[model samples]
Target: MPDADRQDATLEWVERVATFCVEEWGLTPITGRILGLLMICDPPERSAGQIADAIHASRASLTSNMRLLTTIGLIRKVRVPGDRTAYYRIEDDAWEKVIQRKIAGLGAFGDIAEEGLALIDDANPARTERIRAAQHALTWLRDLAARHPRDATT
Candidate 1:
């Protein structure tokens, strides 16, 4: 582990990441903290209690957040032999999986925009144009990511 001051600074940075996840991505603060902690915690795995103490979250909240993260395959719990406590670590490809899922979800928006375009009458092309623009954006994003899967990992 780093020295106390260094650790504190890192934790502060982690909290900023959690705040971004909460405000921009709609993730629970605790969940975001867990993700951020797993990414930087020394030794690469941490018990629930250790995580709770570091993030100033309760055990109960950590339990639920860990469960959700595990269910989504973002993190995993490992049991050490002769030890009862579960230690959690972020998946090696967690960000890749997350980005892939988001990309897949964006594809659905194209379908939605297509349906929206069908709803309006042909006489009002302006409305259809707006819907078309939305679909175009989604397609551009989807194609751009597909073209450069390597960049998406970063």
Candidate 2:
């Protein structure tokens, strides 16, 4: 197969993955496309303009998404001397960190449950028991995450 055909195939796959991520994972298609492209592209790093062109997104959209990715530590920014433009690249353990953070966010929901439980009177046995059940379940999950580390693959 010719190199051009191969490149087209790869880009098509990336677009498909981006669509999947958007529809199933609640991420913007552009974010998924950026990640997909970076994962497969040679050099492993791309300037914002390159990513924008590859994903067919506006420069402003790429800037916004890149900021979000960088803030979440899924991607990192690189600066080469004498170059004004910033390049973005996926971190080695980006997916692992994403999973870990998601689990941690679940744990943080316990505080909301605790607040709700406090609002209910203890004398109301039925309502209190229901709230207690929810709190217990959430606590169990949080504790479970704490006990078991996030898997590298997911």
Candidate 3:
């Protein structure tokens, strides 16, 4: 594809990613756009101004999302030699971190289910079955993730 067409297609994909993040993860569309751009942008790192321009986002709006993404280990800030402007790039293990966080959340929900089970009365064991099911499902997922961890070489 021609360069301009490629860029247009890339932007469309970025918007799709933004929509997905908004619907599924409760993140702002702009946050997802930043992530998508970082994932596929040529040179792999971009200054804030370039990101803002490409995503059609205001610098002010990008700043907080950038900080949040950086804090959560999805992205990182770098300073090129002889260049004072900061650049951002997606972390090499960003997806793994995302999955790890999801697994941690599952573990937390399992703990909560355990507490609920403890509170249920012995006279009504059926009342605790739902909680037990939820706990079991979470435990199964966590175990599955452990059994088939991502290979670093990939």
Candidate 4:
């Protein structure tokens, strides 16, 4: 494809990914746009001004989102010798860690469910059924996340 067409296609994908991040993941549109642009942008790293121009976001917004992303370990800031500006790039294992963190968070819900169930009187075990079921589901999911996968070659 021609350069202009390729650029248009890339932008299209970025918008789609940004939309999903906003709707499915509950991230702000600008943050999603930053992530989308960074995911496909050349050189694997871009300065704040360059990223702002690419995503059409203000420097103030970029700074806030970059700080949040950096704090969460989703991205990193790099500085070159003799240059004051920081370049940002996605973490190599960002998505994997995202999934792991989500799975780890489920453990807390399990604890909550167990506590709820414990509050139910033994004289009425049926009253605890709903909480018990949710606790079981969470337990299963936690176990599933921890278990090893089967070999595809087999």
Candidate 5:
């Protein structure tokens, strides 16, 4: 494909990723765009101004989102010696961190379900069924994750 075609395709794919992040992960479109761009951008790192330009977002909006991503471990700030400009790059294990957080959330919900079960009186199956099902599903997923460990070198 020609360079222009490849660039267009890449932008389309990035938009798709942005949509997924918005609908599934509750992230802002700009945040998703930043992630999408960083994942495929050359050199694996870009400065704040460059990121803002690439995603068509304002520096004002990008600042908070960048801070949030950095705090959450999805991305990090890098400083080149003597440049005084802070660049951003996706973490090497960003996806793993995301998955780990999701699994932890599931486990938290399972604990909440357990508490709900304890609140039920007289061992009522009907009252406990929903909570039990939730707990069971979470446990199953946790077990599955444990059984199939991710390879360290991805």
Candidate 6:
């Protein structure tokens, strides 16, 4: 394929991935764009200015999104010794961290359910059983996640 055609294809893939992130993962369009660009770009790393230009976002917006991504462990900041700019790239275990956080969220829900059970009337056997079932399932899932190793490649 021609070079221009290849570039077009890459941009198309980036758009598709960005849409997926927004629709399925609840990320903002800009966030999805950043992720998509990072995933496909050469060197697998980009400075904030480059990311902003590619995504058509302001530097401030990129700064905020970068902070969020780093906080969530989805991407990491890379500093070259001689350079003042920081580059960002997706972590090898980014998806694993996502899954782990989701599982941990389920465990938090279980905690809430337990608290609700304590406050609810114990005499209502049917209601109690339903809540218990939900809690049990959450607990089981959390335990199952704990037993498995985090997927290293994402």
Q: Write the per-residue lDDT of candidate 6 for residues 1-154, one digit (tens) a residue.
A: 9999998888788889889989988988888888888888999989999899877899988888889999988899999889998999998877777777778888888878778788889799999998898888888777777676453212
Model 2 C-alpha lDDT per residue in residues 55-152, reported as the tens digit of each score: 78998988898898899888999988899988889999987887777666666776577788989888889988887777777777778877776542
lDDT of 5 by residue, 1-154 (tens): 9999998998898899899999999999999999999999999999999999878899999999999999999999998899998999999999998887887788778878878878887567887787899988986766666676574212
Q: Which numbered prediction scores highest in lDDT against the true structure? A: 3
Better lDDT candidate (4, 5): 5
Local error of candidate 3 at residue 120 (angstroms): 0.3
The residue pairs that clash in candidate 5, if any, are none
Which regions of candidate 3 fall more than 4 Å away from where they truly are?
Answer: 146-148, 151-154
1-154: candidate 3 lDDT, tens digit per residue: 9999999999999999899889988999889999999999999999999999999999999999999999999999999999999999999999888878888789789878889988887777777788899999987777777777674212
**Candidate 1 residue-wise lDDT, 34-106, digit = tens:** 8999999889999999999999999899899999999999999998899998899999999899888888688
RMSD of each: 2.1, 3.0, 2.1, 3.3, 2.3, 2.6
Q: What's the candidate order when arranged by decreasing TM-score?
A: 3, 5, 1, 4, 6, 2
Ranked candidates, highest lDDT first: 3, 1, 5, 6, 2, 4
Task: Give the residue spans of candidate 6 off by over 4 A.
Answer: 151-154
Model 3 worst lDDT run, 10 consecutive residues: 145-154
The weakest ten consecutive residues by lDDT in model 4 span 145-154
Give the clashing residue pairs of candidate 6, or none.
Answer: none
Candidate 1, which ten residues in sequence have the lowest lDDT sum?
102-111
Model 1 clashes, total count: 0
Model 2 whole-model lDDT (C-alpha atoms)? 0.83
lDDT tens digits, residue span 51-119, model 4: 898888899988999898889888898888899878999888777767777666786798789899878
TM-score per candidate, chains pooled: 0.90, 0.77, 0.92, 0.86, 0.90, 0.82
For all candidates in order, the CA lDDT equals 0.89, 0.83, 0.90, 0.82, 0.88, 0.84
Q: Which ten residues in a row have the lowest lDDT in candidate 2?
A: 145-154
Determine the C-alpha RMSD for candidate 5 after optimal superposition of all C-alphas.
2.3
Stretches of candidate 4 exceeding 4 Å from the true structure: 122-127, 149-154
- Model 3 residue pairs with clashes: none
Each candidate: how many clashes? 0, 0, 0, 0, 0, 0
Better of 3 and 5 by TM-score: 3
